[model samples]
Target: MIVTRGSRLPLYLAVPVVVLLAALPYLVAPPVTRTLVGLFALVVLASMWNLLAGYGGMISVGQQGFIGIGAYTVLLTDIAGVSPFVGIPFAALVAGLLALPTTALVFRLNGGYFAIGTWVVAEVFRLVTVEFAAVGGGSGASLTGLSALGPTLRGAVTYWCALAAVVLAVGVVFAIMRSRLGLALTAIRDDPTAADSLGVRVTAAKRLVFVVAAAGCGVAGAIIVLDSLRVQPDSIYSVQWSAFMIFMVVIGGIGSIEGPILGAIVFFALQQVLEPYGVWYLVVLGLVAIAAALFARRGLWGLATGGRDVRFLPTGYRVAGSQGGVSGGGSP
Candidate 1:
């Protein structure tokens, strides 16, 4: 691989830039500002999927399990008299805590089994939520009070938090990957047996990634509930949640931070443009994903950057010839 002496910007500078970019809709157009926040929420979910699936070698189809946990955490906490904002962090912790046993169950499987196991977990959670009638149970629950505050302010707050979640997850993933743990993750991804032989603790690493992803995904779930101001166990725990995450990460240039963001942009843009087709919209999306997975390899950005990942977020440090061994060989 040809080395690129890439000059990375300081995270201090990048974080503010990303945060400002997230707030763009709030500043320029008060109307639909919340939509921008929603986009960031999707990015947060996508980032978690990317980290878990892309780097950690675990493709989960049931990440919504934690997402649902987060939503209910907020809803349940609000019922208990805590502020919803305060409940958000608490919700994330709740989700992470819930992840412990689920890991034991799901970890028993590998590859496609692991993926399917995740979906089952999401489904089970959905069914459990349906039994609680006071919270609307099967009918779902609303994020009532916050919805009454109107759009602009809620949009601003959610946007900030969503951006922060994305920033936080991405930053943590970047840091861990740059540190010794990052090296371990890379080794595991490349060859689990060799990584294990090197004493990298494969299962432990995967479990850690899963838990962190669960926490971030939980926050995203809270944001989604906030966005719709409602939560139906069925809707929140739908397998489509996993489907969308897969779509965004796969087409966005899977296994990389930049991939999900680009995929989200393209996914949303396509949705806006082709949504009139109803079911056909999904057909087109599937076809695009199929094609990207089969031929493009690195995704749309790969094509745009000539296969070199030039990150605007400035998250990690790439030593000379450190990554991207195939084809173009980076910035040269």
Candidate 2:
């Protein structure tokens, strides 16, 4: 395994940029900071989804289930007199715990069945949540706990939390990809049967990825409540969140870490520019996703890099003198 000059570039550039972005709330207007909060949330979501489908070879379309769970967990915590801000990590814990039992059920399915089963489980979560009238049931509830803080302070804190979540989400995914577990996941992704035959703990690897991805999505969901100041059944649990994750991952590049970050930026920019067009915004997004799928099979990242195996965050190894490095040696 060898590290290249290009692999170190992102590390050098990321620090100063993260520092600047951390101070953005103080430097920028409320609206800009608010907009960035949304972007950060999207990056978190896309990264988590990418980890699950891109790396684990688990194409789950029901991640919104965990998102809603996280949002509601924050709301519940707030109702119990805890600061909603304090509930963010707790929400992630709850979501991850819930995923444990969920795996017992969904793991039974495979391929497309697994995907649809996950969606059905999410729908179950939504329906069960609707029955609890204490949480506003079919209606929704606004986050009242933040009322104590000044609007500026609240917004700034929320932005910082959202930023922290993005860093954690991407960092966790990157860390996993560089570890022994990453190697197992890559093998599992390429061929689960073969990976299992070769002593890779396929089920365990997939389960870890599933729980981690759920926890990441949980963080994103908690941030969503903080950003919007409300949690609704329809909006929070909407399959549209799943659609957005899929779109961002597919458009950006599915398997690489940088792809989702780049994809999130593209999706955020498009949303900002095209949102005023209302329904057409979705139309444009759908068209763009389709075009990327049809033309840029490897996604925008692959197209931009001319199909070369250029990696800013290399998760795999390069041979002593190989031309394109080892196959499945990059990110999953």
- Reference-based TM-score of each model: 0.88, 0.95
Name the lDDT of candidate 1.
0.78
Among all candidates shown, the one with the greatest lDDT: 2
Which residue pairs of candidate 1 clash? 252-259
**Candidate 1 to truth, TM:** 0.88
Clashing pairs in 2: 316-329
Consecutive 10-residue window with the lowest summed lDDT within model 1: 323-332
lDDT of 2: 0.91
Give the range of the ten consecutive residues with the poorest summed lDDT in model 2. 320-329
